[model samples]
Target chain A: MPKQVDHRERRETIARALWRVVEQRGIAHASVREVAQEAGISHGAVQHYFATREEMLVFAMDFASEQTSLRVAERVAELGDAPHPRDVLRVTLTEMLPLHPEARATSRMSAAYVLEALHDAHIHARAREGLTHGRDLVEDLVRQAITDGHIDPDRDPAIETNLLLALTGLTPLVELGVIEPREATTTIAHHLDRLFTNRP
Target chain B: MPKQVDHRERRETIARALWRVVEQRGIAHASVREVAQEAGISHGAVQHYFATREEMLVFAMDFASEQTSLRVAERVAELGDAPHPRDVLRVTLTEMLPLHPEARATSRMSAAYVLEALHDAHIHARAREGLTHGRDLVEDLVRQAITDGHIDPDRDPAIETNLLLALTGLTPLVELGVIEPREATTTIAHHLDRLFTNRP
Candidate 1:
């Protein structure tokens, strides 16, 4: 058996290759052989990490989601202690959009997964879980803002959360060139201003 | 030479078969042969209408979108001349969601196209056009509501249009059973209430 570190490294390498294939072609075209060729590894090596194509795709999806979460965490850390509630909410939500080239791939994977989830139960559950987690995060922030007097106490946090997170649904339009990334960001900022009661 | 009526009828038949294939097995598995088999027509007949696979897919997408629009128009016609703005907005947006069995297929196809648009230039353009059209419809509705004093005039019509239509983004989650269709409708109604100043 390989050591733990080697096993983790091999899996990471395979997942990255899978993402590249998914990014270049649609997920439908990301066959095991395609990923193997992209990774410069044998099909057997790729199988050693993920026995089935579904397994590989699921792992890659989770990995892409984790990468986004990590980036958000890093950005929050850079904001230092006591970041404004609106600023934190803005940064976190903006990170979810495909505003940057680096984020475009993950956003694409996510959009692909939404369709896949329609046909597959397991993928559906994972996609649902990811969306729920995102909603919960935004809801928490909205609740904090309300408590901090940044937003109206009369507003329903869940509805606000849903509305705010739904804006990320425009991510595909941004990616498809229907709207500019800057336009999406501007829309988000505009909505945020409306949500906050006391604007600086 | 085929008559104009025959040309239109044949294309519509082929497009319906293509939609069935897409609904059953997803857009990736929708091949010309599969669509032909489903339509009970010869492969040559299918080819006579659509010389290429992309042409067939694009036609089916437009057909499906048109079907949804027709449904919306029919629904609005039934609502009489004095329909409230909120009711009009709710019904229009609800029609876009995959809340019914009939709509689930079109919703799935739309979701699949979001991924396809990422890799195909022609599809990207068509998808962009559809999104822009949807946004415009919603924006126009918001403007009318503001003018009628149904909503606050201070709200940015474009931003409100974006946020309202973005709720349709939750359609996938509803289709996947992550949330009930009723919950989505409820959320839509909740937001509409928040938008209107004098909710009875």
Candidate 2:
């Protein structure tokens, strides 16, 4: 009898291989043949899962976003009604950091896709959706903080949301050694504290 | 007799063509042959100036950085000695925005080079140098703001510098229409005003 493979497991394996290729060679090289080689499969095998390179890229980008969301949700769940907006924001934003191998790999892959999106409309649309989703999550958290009286009521949610996203973009720069990590972390923390703290 | 182009002018033309190709077709298609065709020159003609694709990329990346620096320097020069630090910072950061076509093209090319830097060591080195130079400029401005009593003396320069750079990275997202441009601009302006204002 032919060997039976778990379909979801195989797809995950392929996605993981795609992430590695993106991380190691940049997304420009995340072609079918390249990802197949990384996945220890034939190009046809990759085609079996993804009809086109765009399909694979879209799936991979979505997968990464989902993973990040799940991670943040898990962490937030653990927070268990933490009233402090700063604490909630810190946990959510820091979860996106490349503090471990998994997070680092995901970040590299996501960054590659983001750059790729600038060139490909399909990827661009998906990236926009992902960005909106992520921004919404952070925005909601900020709103929650306000509702809980953790953040200054006078603060603008729209401004704080953009600031948080901007800070998140600095993580890959730090991971890539473009900025000193300690300084990046300290700078982000200080800015966050200022945004959250009460001051006359 | 064949016309002889000035070496510096030839190289600059090739770099501009490279950037145009990047903006038109995305960085994924920025090969020597394509760039040469875009410049209406022979492939060998491109090599005459750049030697190799990697060298071309580095030169192109440097050109973009230089463009940004020149713009900022020109604005700073106009400010003279009595310029407000807040105004200087706002103007300098705004120069990095993809508000106009030239800046937009440059921003696209820079993003392409940034993705390439992830996998190309030479490109990565150049990117690191460019980022460091930018950060240094921001740090100097931050220090000046403090000395001018435009910002809080207790505000950390390092963090402020990162915040400024992070804000630059977020601009493309807005320009690309991945995020609402109005929201981005307003949010950035609000944050900068809050961060740099002396009145607290």
Candidate 3:
């Protein structure tokens, strides 16, 4: 038999090269030839994997999203049966925060993808879908929290979900050290607490 | 007599070219030659102003921040004497949000700068300073709101200011239409009202 070739693995290998490029030189350096050089592959190999640069960018973004989702799922799986709704929400949303090294790494790439989403329809759709999925998940959590009497019953799940979703956008400030990690923690905590309280 | 050259004007023109490059092709295409071509100047002219690409990026980011500040100031100046503190804040912050066409344009460039700030120290400092300046202004408004009895008497101005400052980062989502303009307005309104209330 000829040498075995796993196309998926090769693609991921190329994607990792893109990640390395982003890490070392930022997305400005993630050209096809540059990524190919990083991956120790020929230009044809990169072309074989992605027909266009936009396709490669889309795949990289999707790959990053899957990594983040896996990290969240891994943590969620480790939770005990019927964990406090607040704690579950916090832990799940923590992956969206740049409070940890892993989340910070993913956020680095995610931010670039967000900027790209402005000019690219595929990226905009993917990002919009990702954000919608996140907010829907938040709505479910809010409902669960309300049902468990862990949060205020009067909260509008839609707006509340957006509020929580918007807080994740603050991660770059934290990553930049403009806002301390403790401050970001406090802000997120305050938002969650306000949701739970009925006092106004 | 020798012709007089305004260095500031030259830099701004080059920065405008960078902005146009960002606007037309995204920042990924903002190479020195491209920006020089866009500015109708020579590559040596671009090199003359900034020794390195990083230096040029810094200048462009600073230029954008200055542009944002000027727009905010102009809007504030348009308001009547002692306008409602809430309205003042809403209008000022609306500039920071991608709720309008102009803001969405600046935000396109801004989000790209933010993503770059994560890896570049100089960009990080510029971003940090800009954010700190914003929060300080928010603190001033929060103080005025409290003094004027427009907001809660016991609110932590620091946290409230941070909350408002962090909200500006959500412009990318708004640009992507992940958060509709009405929703963003509602979110900001809710946040401002919460600050003004004794809500827990």
The digit string of per-residue lDDT tens for model 1 on B32-120 reads: 99999999999999999999999998988898898888888888888999888888888888888887765776777777777788789
Off by over 4 Å in 1: A147-149, A198-200, B1-3, B198-200
TM-score of chain A of 3: 0.86
- The local distance difference test score of each candidate is 0.81, 0.78, 0.76
Q: Per-residue lDDT tens digits of candidate 1, residues A131-175?
A: 877777788988888888889898889777767767777776777
Candidate RMSDs in Å, in order, are 2.5, 3.1, 3.6
Going through the candidates in order, state the TM-score of chain A alone for each one.
Answer: 0.93, 0.87, 0.86
DockQ of 2: 0.61
Task: For residues B1-200, write the lDDT of model 2, one tens digit per residue.
Answer: 23455876787788889899888777877899999999999998898888899988888878887887788778888988867777677777777767677777787777777668778888878887787777787799889888878888988887788888788767646845756656666766887788777843
Question: How would you encode candidate 3's per-residue C-alpha lDDT over A1-200 as one tens digit per residue?
Answer: 13235777787788878877776577888889999999999999899989988788788877878888898878777887866666666666667777776566567777777777777788789888987776677789888787777778877777777777777767767866777888887877766666777423
Q: What is the DockQ of candidate 1?
A: 0.61
Q: Taking the tens digit of each residue's C-alpha lDDT, what string does model 3 give over B83-120? A: 67776777777787766655665666677777677678
Model 2 reaches what TM-score against the true structure?
0.91
> Residue B176 deviation, candidate 2, in Å?
4.1
TM-score of each model's B chain? 0.93, 0.89, 0.84
Segments of candidate 2 deviating more than 4 angstroms: A1-5, A77-83, A198-200, B1-5, B77-81
Clashes of 3: 0
